[model samples]
Target: MKKKVLFYLGILIAWFPAFSQTDNSVSAITEAREQLVRKNHEKSYVSHILTGKRYDLKYRGAVNSQFFRDIYPSYGTLVYDGVFFDHIEIQLDIYQEKVVVLLESKNNEQFVTIDNEKVSELTFNNYKFVHIRHDSIMSDGLYQHAFQGKHSDTFIKRTKLKKDKIENTKMIIEFVPLDKYYIKNDWGTFAITNKKSFLKAFQNSEAVVSIVKKNKTKFSKKKIENGLLKAVSLLDPLLIDN
Candidate 1:
């Protein structure tokens, strides 16, 4: 199994040079090449290739519809396995919770899913993803990383997909946002559905609550994020220096 994976991974890397020949792919390729030349880190790098079963468009049971159909050819940047790759056109498969990148093939362009375990941080479609340990647990997974640099407190958004039935004849897919706001604080991860809950979760409750109160408007997801950023700025020094 390892040999098979490595073989395909090699093939994928071989095609990378073709991408570099184009002006658009030069920045990312040059960056990766420079890193290979300069960095002394010895971590093993893997370029995941979309194989027969893992390929989404050709998969059997997957819904023909996708969460990111509306947003395609969206160029972005990502750091995978500590190597910087930029100027990538990608689509977010929210249903499968995967980042799909467009790659060139002999026949045409193909869509390949990125292995999330290799992704350190990714940004596209105005959303950011970072590996995080949920609820202060040891296990790390990807979340729409919101606020960073607040050592003890980070804000993130988690998403999931829900399938809705359209009568008995058809179906529709929806990107159901599950608990869009969360505060990973010193205690643990806490969902922020309202102002009171937000105050109770963070040690800097006064600053957080004050921000909310000053808004004097109905609470919203955007407001929660803005408030968290402010509160995090206030709490960053204490959390980081400790």
Candidate 2:
């Protein structure tokens, strides 16, 4: 594997001259060259290290018709086996609870899944997620990283429940979200659902509430997290520090 990784990277440096030939100005050439090399390095790492079984596009008895967020792939970054890779094409299968990568070859599209254990952190569609085994904060699985504060942090665990409906003659499958929110500080991790629960988690509810309002954080009852995330972030520093 080590030899393969180097072999793939060796092919990338071979095109270093292209960066200089494109621009006569030194600064432009240097900046542009750095960007190109970085992108190519990511490609090399993705192609070499991240490889697995074919990710079938067709639903093979998947709970919902669309367990995936989108049929198309988006570019994102991830940490695998302590190595960080960026600018790679990816898709999230929330129902299956797996990370899939899209690869291209000879004018054809291919998809593959990375090892579950190797994926520790990932970002896609503007959401950051982490999977920790044996976590004291909550269940040892995937959690959408909502906020990372100085003394504390917040994580949201979202799960899609399977639902079936009859649409005409055909049976249709759908996914509905059931999410849990958590606040973790130096002391412990607590599942906070609303303002009352949040206030109860800390010793001084009034002080935390005051800071949260001062920060102008918003939460409400809707198809949302009810504002606990921003509240936790604003109050953590004030509450934990004192």
Candidate 3:
């Protein structure tokens, strides 16, 4: 009787490893299926479409108005919460000063406004925009992304809707406003009031002063975007090092 019992015990021990291996395989397959379902759900649910808001102007790809860049509704990529989404259509709503994206919905396509705070950076058409803390006399600590160097020295082309009356007919005109450049200094941020005031602002930086004096022709008028950008480029390194 004792010999028979020992023989059965040996058989049970040999079967244990096979049973454990089979259970592990089953668990792995179940976990993989669950992950796939979650991924699909995120793809369908994590979308935003604009409705009932007058803030975003419809981007009709018309050349009637001035924009941040010439390209409208161009293919672009956006980064949010450190995740990247590509093959998306984007446009700059200058009137609203926000980056708008076109998203696909079951019924139709809709416009979605991206949250500035969640957006780390955006690349649209040929421009790269990054959020920065801007301080200026007109606005204070306003958070927005312009061209990369725009924070250091800002250049903007803005448009305002104006009414034009001719022969008792009132027509809306896309009025292009005067361009201006604002520079940030240790003292504070302010627009270039005049040639002499700008020179005084950068008076400490001899290199910038010399550049401005050399290209005095450009600063003859109120707006000198290219020259102003060049001056900021030269002084940026010094600002960073300090």
Candidate 4:
């Protein structure tokens, strides 16, 4: 009788740990989802369709355009214009021992560092002229039809959960292409003028997203690269023409 009791007790002990782990996992997912929802509601977190110097010069296919090289003084600069009323600049500071992001705009400037060490800085090229334009009337009509109504897919769901001890997480999210619609509609005009620049600029946008998603310290470069690649693969297919 005692032997049987001991056996059952041992089983219970083992079972409890597994149960606890499962519960913790569920709780983590819930928390992550909540965080993502909050982020989605925040204007800063919403994806913007931007038109910028890079877009204009690149779409014009001026491969030799000095503007292309001039914007990125360093490889770490990421610029997005046209989503908001102005441009959004995100700069990664790699000169320091740690990696960080610098976010800047006309009304606000701040540094957001990962792991509390590296500082990212945001800057606007004072020499450059920033032009802000509303989406073309046709593009605006599509935007309303696709995203503004009850059927809108613009508000995407994103979740990130740490999957390994190396501080890397699995991020799953939906991305609606707010810009692609305009691109597709205007493709003929833009492509004819600047095929090379347009292609390069599009590729650059993909690269920037990869960098943002894979920005981390603990993971190997290969692992980070793979993560970014996987993320882009999943999201790219969901982008619509409008």
Point to the candidate with the largest TM-score: 2
lDDT, candidate 2, 1-242, per-residue tens: 55765664565556456645655644655665577667667876544456667877665454544444565678898887778889988877776677888766778777898887778898888988898577675977778888898877888876777777787887767777667888877667888766666766675568787865686545544522646765665676675564
Model 4 vs truth, CA RMSD? 23.9
CA-lDDT, candidates in order: 0.62, 0.71, 0.56, 0.31
Candidate 3: pairs in clash:
none
Better of 2 and 4 by lDDT: 2
Which candidate ranks first by lDDT, i.e. highest?
Answer: 2
- How should the candidates be ordered by lDDT, best one leading? 2, 1, 3, 4
105-191: candidate 3 lDDT, tens digit per residue? 788777777665666666776666554444345442122233334226553433334334344563444534444456656555656
Q: Candidate 3 has what TM-score?
A: 0.57
Error of 2 at 25 (Å): 55
Q: What is candidate 4's CA lDDT for residue 40?
A: 49
Off by over 4 Å in 1: 1-54, 57-70, 105-108, 134-139, 149-154, 168-170, 173-175, 185-189, 217-242
Q: Write the per-residue lDDT of candidate 1 for residues 45-160, one digit (tens) a residue.
A: 44444332244553333344454444445888878767777888766665566777777778887777777877788788777777764445324666676666645556454545
In angstroms, give how far residue 152 of model 3 lies from its true place. Answer: 5.1
Q: Runs in model 2 with CA error above 4 Å?
A: 1-48, 58-69, 104-109, 211-224, 240-242
TM-score for all predictions? Answer: 0.59, 0.68, 0.57, 0.18
- Cα miss at 13, model 4 (Å)? 24
